[model samples]
Target: MRLITQSLLVLALGVGLARADGETAGEFDYYVLSLSWSPNWCIREGDARDADQCDARHDFGWILHGLWPQYDRGWPSFCPTRHRNPSRSDTRAMADIMGSSGLAWHQWQKHGRCSGLSSDAYFALSREAYATVTHPDAFRRLKQPIRLPASVVEEAFLAANPNLSAGQITITCKDGGIQEARICLTRSLEFRDCGADVQRDCNLNRATMDVIR
Candidate 1:
């Protein structure tokens, strides 16, 4: 019995250490494109989605588009712009990272219709490269307003979208900086087009997605 208990304790300790790296849910300010392992994305079914889902080995040939920062335009060889059209396809392409399991994801829609290439957000773990790590403790209790940087991200949003009649950007932060952020979805979400800087006003929504009346 003593030996068995000792072995069990050792096993439990090993498991804990393995997951300790996962405890820290990295800061999620906005969103990231590619995460790790540099996944390969390709087009499928015209409205098809995901890169690795179609090709993996020589899949780099199909990369149409990806999230920002993670997969910036610095590398033209990786982006597949010919097939990427946020106005049409609801899904987009992306590269995956290792140890990124259990990451929360979302799809953006403007004015009740889908808009923008599907971007991803994750909890960074250790380094900025691995910042995609998510916080395990912030679940259910995670309820905070979306905030944008005053001079940088905020000002840009106000200038890009004309729908924001309020012309004001608010930042909701805890440590004097943003940790979580979001704007109201578009009208297609069934929400009214109230005259204020809503969530949709910041990001493209159904109304914004459609250029034609």
Candidate 2:
């Protein structure tokens, strides 16, 4: 009876750890800062709906998608089922980078609500995370298509940012061009290794990154 009880206790502890790393609402282990390559996004998603971002007037490179809270294998979303409306000041502050008021609100509603932070604090953290990453010069403007191994692209980012490593990020592609760089961060917004399940998504031997002019 004593041995059986001990085994049951160990199993219970393991289960608890697993739950902490699953889709537990309003609770998370870290964050995934998704930096979208704007040129590829425009090409794939079209420029009509988000004309302000995809238009010729704004030559955006890497833009913030969202600071998404993540668990080990999964993440939480639509948490609490209710969210406060973003203030004008916060909305305007995030607009230039996040692309639009609607996108900003949607991000907060889905990802931010699960962050266990208020609207003001969550947006502030998102800005800080965006400022933390340094983009390589090659990525600043892709006047022509640049084809390189996806790992090489990840290395470029690692070289530019001192605190990051190969395991901390994954390069994602779409429509024959690099679409985004999904990087892992601590809850406090420091660079960290992603969970094992966050594998590299681009299968091409060499990937292209199209530049926006």
Top-scoring candidate (lDDT)? 2
Candidate 1 lDDT at 46 equals 17
Q: How far is candidate 2 from the true structure (C-alpha RMSD, Å)?
A: 8.0
**lDDT score for residue 24 of model 1:** 18
Off by over 4 Å in 2: 1-25, 48-50, 81-83
Give one digit per residue, the lDDT tens place, for model 1 in 49-126.
Answer: 442334434322111121222111111112211122232222322223321121222212211011122222211211
lDDT of 1 at 62: 12
State the local distance difference test value for candidate 2: 0.81
Pairs that collide in candidate 2 are 142-211
Candidate 1 global CA lDDT score: 0.26
Residue 191, candidate 1: Cα error in Å is 8.7
Question: What TM-score quantifies how close candidate 2 is to the native fold?
Answer: 0.82
lDDT of 2 by residue, 1-213 (tens): 999999999999999876565244568889999988877777677565555778777777888999999988778886763447677777767977877666788898789888878888889899999999998777775568788777777888989998898889998887667878899999888889899877666766677777775
